[model samples]
Target: MNAVPFRRIGFDIARDVLGKPDILLLDVRDPASFERGHIARAENASPINLGRFLTETPKEKPVLIYCYHGNSSQAYAKAFSESGFGEVYSLDGGYEGWATANARAAAAAPRLSETLKAFLIAQGFPPDDVNAVGKNQMTPLMQAAHLGPAALVAELLAAGARVDAMNSDGSQPLWLACVGDDPEIVALVIKAGADLEHKNVNGSTALMYAASASKAKALMALLEAGADLTYENDGFSALDMAGSRECLDLLRAAQRRLKAAS
Candidate 1:
């Protein structure tokens, strides 16, 4: 059976649909509010991001949308539906409504596991430091950047995980993104205000990591973002770390341009 489009679902239904892997949850709210908080794994809808979502998201994936008071979601739902999406839903009361409903449910909800709390303590985090990280201080955002569907990275960034939080060894999330080799995630971090030239303990910049990992797209994104090719990590410039011929060519070409412009 074909699923209905622009269906407004209450909290109960919304909750169930959220667990589905194929569902695309979108929060159609402003960036600041999204940074404050929103549904887990939910992508924030901004003008530019919405265009990308509409372009890239598969039409078959069911779309679940919510907004501040729920009214705006219906309009967004209509747009998604008209754009040929198969299943699109709007939260009945929007985020505010969902919050109210969720609060009511949590009142009787089972207590959260102390196992996680214990694990956090063992990992060297202070008892109240609820930020997900181990003794190494690699936040969830860092892990997701290094390995992701790219959506999780976006969700974490929207939910205000510090984009530039470095690990014990001083590896930034942007560096991990280069290891992951996803240009899209690199761009996402860049948009989230990652310092392109911020170096680690060894002074390796994101560009250096990208070159070492060997992918034209990731390296290209950093180069296009104006990453400093001159900055050497432990005296190893990105040119020295170039793993792909394409990246090498890009570095050389970008270098010549820099010289000409200077």
Candidate 2:
């Protein structure tokens, strides 16, 4: 039997991921098509390897599958979901919808890397204006950390923008990134030196936010980056407000690290 291309969701693959951070994008299109252009953070999976993709996929995570036309992939989605992949969704219109939404009519020339760099420089960025813009108390860096391209975030960091710089409510870009469920973006900010210990208005740490949202990957990443376990928000440490056993376990592990360090 041939594989399914489309499932139940109402849009193409790129739009699906663009709308939500928690959704994992599984592009089943051909390698050439995928290499030409694809959504950010999307992974390639040939329809022929259906069983392999299904086995590797996490049950706890939501899966959004798609292909070139939304036809063959549709059948595959149903079969896989019934086989036990709960929360499986397919791109309704397939790559056709994606093309209609994103493809330009004619071939547009790609910008040279040097030109792009100069454009960014002309914008007065990367530590020059990023921090100056934040002097008004509005965190442009935090806003950039929310979405992709990450150019602004880079600019701010180069400009010496505080990685631990907090918003009016004490929420740093790292904390906001976690709350937004952007593990990739969160990782970038942390790599740029985002302070895990910084708290928000409620004194909630990024770890606490990841715990409340059941974001296992985010939670683990925060812990590995050395987020403080004993740090309390308002009055509760992350463990005090953790929603599940997994979260509690993470806090316990963090506690052990603290004891060992001491």
Candidate 1 collision pairs: none
- Model 1's lDDT to the true fold? 0.77
Compare the candidates by lDDT and give the number of the best one.
Answer: 1
Clashes of each: 0, 13
Q: For candidate 2, give the lDDT.
A: 0.64
- Candidate 2: tens digits of C-alpha lDDT, residues 17-96: 33342455677888888888665456887757777767876765567777777775676677667666656777777776
